[model samples]
Target: MLIDMSVTPLSADDRQRYARHLALAEIGEAGQQRLAASSALIIGAGGLGSPAALYLAAAGVGRIGLVDYDSVEASNLQRQVLFTHDDIGAGKAEVARARLLALNPRLAVDAHAVRLGPSNALDIFRRYDVVLDGTDRLAVRYLVNDACVLAGKPLVSCAIHRFEGQAMTYIPGRGPCYRCLHPLAGDALVPSCAEAGVLGVLPGVMGTLQATEAMKVLLGVGEPLLGRLLVYDALAMSFQQFSFQRRANCAVCGDNPTITRLEDDGEATMIEEWTPEELAQQLEGARAGSLLLVDVREPHEWAAGRVPGSVHIPLGTLAARATEIPPDRTPVFICAVGGRSMAACRYFAGGGRPAINLAGGVTGWSAVHGPLPRPEGCQS
Candidate 1:
């Protein structure tokens, strides 16, 4: 990407616009110019991508691409700072593209309002100087990393779960790819932001780091996070680093690779929760008699309210007290909304219990059928 440095001659307006960057001795005019010439692709224009795209565009990254097939939901406004309330129901990629261009008219923004899959990942990745993994899904993480490896593009990946987040860079042979760092399908077991919840500002912190790393990779400035993980704990207000190495058998980046081409991992596909109405209908059927309604929310939540006839067994203790759930009755896991219960469902399904996830959980249940009456032994 050295060509980015001399892609275009800086005009007088460019000097005025990037005066701050020009003032930085390290990233003076030439580096800023390189930034103005470089291109980046940010997968998933939500959470991490929100801040990264804004900062990168603000920093004058010359060309930018956004890939996301999702539409803006009202719930997205909490953290996906890229879209406003008015933008809800709009395509995320299109809205993000318009916003980014509005933020920096000089740079060009490409909106791929489509999902990134095996067919398009490599083609799109090949055009960018670097790829930023802002997507939340683990399967996509593997897809992005593998595509980057095959395309020989540098990758900057970040993820936020609840109040904590982590980031790393994969520069092919320079260090471990994502698969090496997280060598297994452990992420399938991890809860998503929808399931675990997140601090509204956490992704901002992590995404900014991604933008910073992208500049470093392009400008060849400071040491990038090539062979290490940057971990951040918001509650503790601390940052930690853990080092890792490229695995000899990374499956995709290893010496004897098995994943030369991208393919869908069935386990990586997230299970869709049943609708609130659908769950209600299921609960009404005679089958509900044979179903065990187990509440997996925290004790405080359980004490506050629960679906009538539901048994309380907090998620943390469920693994240890598994036998408490009756095998005779098909277990139907429920939580505040649906995330924890979905995780529980996955866990049980993996164990061959094959339980059902109460789509919206108690909260969703209440939304569709009004507040539940507090049981005799419960306190709000």
Candidate 2:
């Protein structure tokens, strides 16, 4: 995905603004012009997008597109540094576009305030030379990767969870795409930052790396993360690289690719859910005994705090200890957030038993009702 480096003469303001970039021999005048000519489409305006978008805009990526459907939630401020408290309730993409334009007025910022689905992914992707996938949603991650492959655009993909972050690059005919690494779309059961919690600086680090990779690919100078997974641990302050080859049977970028066109990647099996407010009312009523709250978080998380009357059953051992869950009572699954509990619901559904997920999990309950009451008892 070589950007057409038709040298665009930089204006006086551009040269003065990118004076530091002009000093680098690798970048100098030509690379700065290349960046000014290149375009990048960022597929999320959350934590990763915040830093990536800011850097690209400051570095003079002439054209930038932001695609995000979510609005600013108070939770986003912890990592999504693109917005301030004043920007809450506003569309993320729109806010990001405004911030980028403020950083570099020369940038052509396109704010697509919509979800990137299969129907429009290719169309939007065709307009950019490089794609940056900063989305935490697994299904959307795969979609972005596949769309880049199909649209013949290079993609810089990065994700952060807790204190750890991972980044990789995929170029058409260059190396493996994301699907080659995680082959199953159903693997969306993995916890996101919302469920697992992340260090505030984690995305800042990874997103900056993503921006760097996109610039490298755009400049066609340094080695992009192609064919390699770069993993960073903020806690340990360590970086590790794992090399992977393009899988021969990859459904998208393989020798005989099955995915001829972009289609929505089926998410994990949907399960019955109970909102925090709904579950709270149920617990206060006579139905409390008839419904059981099963906490599926780890032992450490269990010790932190738990809903009153909830029974602890760590997710890893749920299968082996299924008998402990009374069949007479309808089991309601819970975790730190809702992700692991959803997996628990899926497990029960597979065995022909009806189960309910605690939407947003214990965190949601705490958020709605202040804090969880002390657990009555711990059951394993």
* Local accuracy by lDDT, each model: 0.82, 0.85
Per-residue CA lDDT of candidate 2, range 1-380, in tens? 65777777988988899999999999989889999889999999999999999999999998999999878979899999999999998999889999999888878999999877877999999999999999865546777888898889999999888889999999899898998988753453444434658899999999999999999998888888888999999889999999998999998889898787875333222345677899988888997888888998887677778987888998878888988988888789999777788777767765768788887788878988887666545443
- Which candidate tops TM-score? 2
Candidate 2 ranges with C-alpha deviation above 4 Å: 2-7, 185-194, 267-334, 341-361, 365-380
Which digits, one per residue and each the tens of the lDDT, describe model 1 over residues 1-380? 43445567889988988899999998998888888889999999999999999999999999999999878977788899999999988999999999998998999999998778777888898889999999865557877888998889999999888889999998866889998988754434443325548899999999999999998988889999988999999999999999998889887899998777765433223333455677677778877777777888877677777888888777777788889877787777788767677667666755666676776578778877899767675553
Candidate 1 has an lDDT of 0.82
Models 1 onward score TM values of 0.75, 0.78
In terms of lDDT, the best-performing candidate is 2
Distance from true location, Cα of 62 in model 2, Å? 1.1
Clashing residue pairs, backbone N/CA/C < 3 A, model 2: none
Q: How close is candidate 1 to the true structure, as a TM-score?
A: 0.75
